[model samples]
Target: MTRLFNDPTAFADELIDGFVAAHPGHVRPVRGGVVRATRCTSDTVALVIGGGSGHYPAFGGLVGPGIAHGAAMGNLFASPSTQQIVSVARAASNGGGILLSYGNYAGDVLNFDAAEAQLNAEGIPTRTVRVTDDIASAPASEKHRRRGIAGDLTVFKVAGAAAEAGYVLDEVVRVAELANERTRSFGVAFTGCTLPGASEPLFTVPEGRMALGLGIHGEPGIGETDIPSADGLAQLFVEELLAELPEGVASPKGRRVALVLNGLGSVKYEELYVVYGCIARRLQEAGVTIVEPEVGEFCTSFDMAGVSLTLFWLDTELELFWRAGADTPGFRKGLVSPRPRVSAESGVQKKPSSEAVMVPASEESRAAAPRIVAAVDAIAAVIDAHVEELGRIDAVAGDGDHGIGMQRGATAARAAAHAAVEAGAGAGSVLLRAADAWSDRAGGTSGALWGVMLRALGTRIGDEDAPDAHAIAEGAADALAGIRSYGKAEVGDKTMVDAIVPFVETLVARVIDGEQLGDAWDAAAAAATAAAAATADLLPRVGRARPHAEKSLGTPDAGAHSFGLIATAVAATLTRKDFAR
Candidate 1:
């Protein structure tokens, strides 16, 4: 368990600050995360890797000359905000394009994809390669959907080496995709990890038991079993990976494989070495040749008592990149020459924008700003009331951060809305400000979705006029479209879309049928509530919950639950006498 921390919320920031202070030669502080202190060759592709921060050396530690050029580090167990990824990418970009790589988690995918689109829109070429190497997460037929584990290193190394070799963006992406395909990983945990301020572990195993197929985010394993001996565990890992060879590889025998016997936090290096002894023997007996085996913590879950084994089948091309010399804060190989450092004053911080975007509004629209603020406040209060329960529900199948992320987003939105109202902003401007604050503070899939939803609604409810029932219905429809456009989740995917779609459809229908705004909203909120509750019967087809879909069989999605709760809360504000007019 984590024992030292001033505040759990500030832990990630403080950790990054200390890391930069300690490794000034390797990494420098950037607005979103840390970038390589060493200069990169102009016109060489830049590799930017990132994810939630708990995985130590995985992201920030890998930023240097022969690895990632920059890393977009996020809060503990949450994906980096889109802005963070963009900033890091921008700082790392030279004349060449940017290549984004990371584990294939839902939040990471959503945020990274958003940043990729934005970079492209700004005329900076960008590409992404999601590492999917955890064989336990999905079936062979659906290998593309597997979660990345320790195998993230294999992909990142190949991509980074390709970039350092001065390969163009497309070639670098090809090498990354090939590396992802060749890598396979499996893991088991003796115990779950605890967050800094949490009293208990995120999940736990019974004494003398081990959890199989565990995720790095403290998600409970898919199954449990009696603890196995070191040799037994190594055999289990080797057999599982050997069962499914890469498409071109017929067998592990005679293949040169790069192996990583990684300790997941609390597991000691000596323990890994003991396990690797068995692994080495097994591979030699099977006529497999091991090349440059790594035995230590690579990607970790804070203090999880677990280990994972990754096998990267190496071809001639991959072997060259795999053996390439590299230097970084965490991992290093061979000799690396020092490069010039970026000036701290010029490259360290990104100045905040002082320019404000003020949209003109009519007197009637401006008068409705207080109601928008009240609506956001109501959302915050309702989320606060049910936050714990929502987290518990999410913990059943997903990482338990949904409640906290939503709470943070709602609280920030409320503050931003109130501030905008005080500044004589209208309903649209208040909602737009709230959207920005929500996305900036929350920093996850839920945060990005909420940002899109609010911004879409605000665009439809422009500040030039008092929004009527028709405009409100249109705004709801636009919100739905925005969510679908950004998140790509369908109505039956067991996400917030399940509730949002129903709410939007019902609201639009009721308003078209001549119902008042308040009446339509009340009806829509009821529909959302029912839809959220009904998610218990539907299997999750997207997000982090998808891997543990069975575990969530009897529980509603946390995002859906929060959406329903906020819709109901906002209905009250809509029905108020002063706002109803």
Candidate 2:
């Protein structure tokens, strides 16, 4: 992996030099790799933010009129030395003392503190504000000691706004402290992030598993678990934050939340927003009103595949500064909020209620209740039986969550079946029931994909006749087509398609070959078994597990494994009578 750099050692310095060259009126580079952005005056208190590099628009790009006065930029993922922080402190501070801010990291505290004392000796009163918003880092006993994740932007913005509004150094630091106190963040990593010029990642996150509570530096999060959808993951993250919310943040007045959807490194803002939509819905359900939301890559790691959500409890005054107009290169003034602008608008605005959307299940779904229930029960049993086997394979190539995912899906499917049966619903209705239940229980693409397949199959079953080669083959074809339509994956993607494609194809071929339904199913099962084996030679073509393509070269996909298990269950449905003389 090539990087955009002249050299790793002087990457920060060279970038700062070029930046000053490009914007001479805006900034000037100093010793120890600090960039003092212009407007260095003796009248106003200065804002100094610093940290390791790679998280751009931070500690550097954020330097401007309403942002930081100057930034003590560090090397890539490396905190600046004490001397560097001290030098930037002096350069940025004119007559007014400085308020220093950085993420919650040991090296940053040490270096910045040393700089603070040094500036104090020079008659420049200095204060340090540490951003510690990651709620996943510690419990209440250690909340003050948790690592800062993405909420640093809110801290920077609040602190900078205070300073720009002519607040004294002490007041500016107070704002920073308040921002940190109000904020909480948590995240899960899909994969570890690799640093610039490094061949390997800073850490390894097992495939198909999300490391909940993962730190910015690729640290272990809550023990690895099955990767859920963007919606489910957001729910988990928000619930964790809600569980750990500090006392004294009430609603409608003193209770306002400032949300920050921060990209850890490589995850895009669009994906982050999909997760944010989940969180927003849940928070509203909980009666926590959003004061303001800043959604974008405010703070980031180095191409780490993860996202962090930060919620800051706000007071009336703090909320004002948060909404205050400011223009930084990356963070600009936000849109006019729907709330009363307090700037004296003419008329009271009417808020529109949402229109309800309704979709009814297909009639086919209403007719196939018994078959759907039986299928779900048998499939659940298969998962229960092969749990250890699936885990063993996953342990070799992933974080070992495949068994958990499958079992969870089966459990959900069974629950949906039971509910449908109790309600006297048909198969199609039961499948529609399974869709939401399965998504709630299972976490990844396969989980939703399979649930959709079941739902679609249920709808088709209304037209399905009693077991016969032609009817069975057609129904099987419908199920497979529905799966393909929902998942949008081609055959040979090394997914469940390995078993699914051949299983359906073989059944169709057998029916055309004049076989009975039982004989066709047998043939289909055998073909699926072959496809599962053939998966050993295929490459991954989709999902989070795709990157590790070559790694599972000789292993059967868990999807294929799950399909084979289902086929076995279907085959077992056939029985032989006690043989007589």
Q: Give the range of the ten consecutive residues with the poorest summed lDDT in model 1.
A: 572-581
TM-score of each: 0.96, 0.56
**Residue pairs whose backbone atoms clash in candidate 2:** 228-443, 264-301, 365-428, 365-429, 368-427, 369-427
lDDT of each: 0.89, 0.68
For 49-123, candidate 1 gives per-residue lDDT tens digits of 998888899889999988899999887888888988999999999869999999998888999999999999999
Off by over 4 Å in 1: 348-351, 579-581
Top-lDDT candidate index: 1
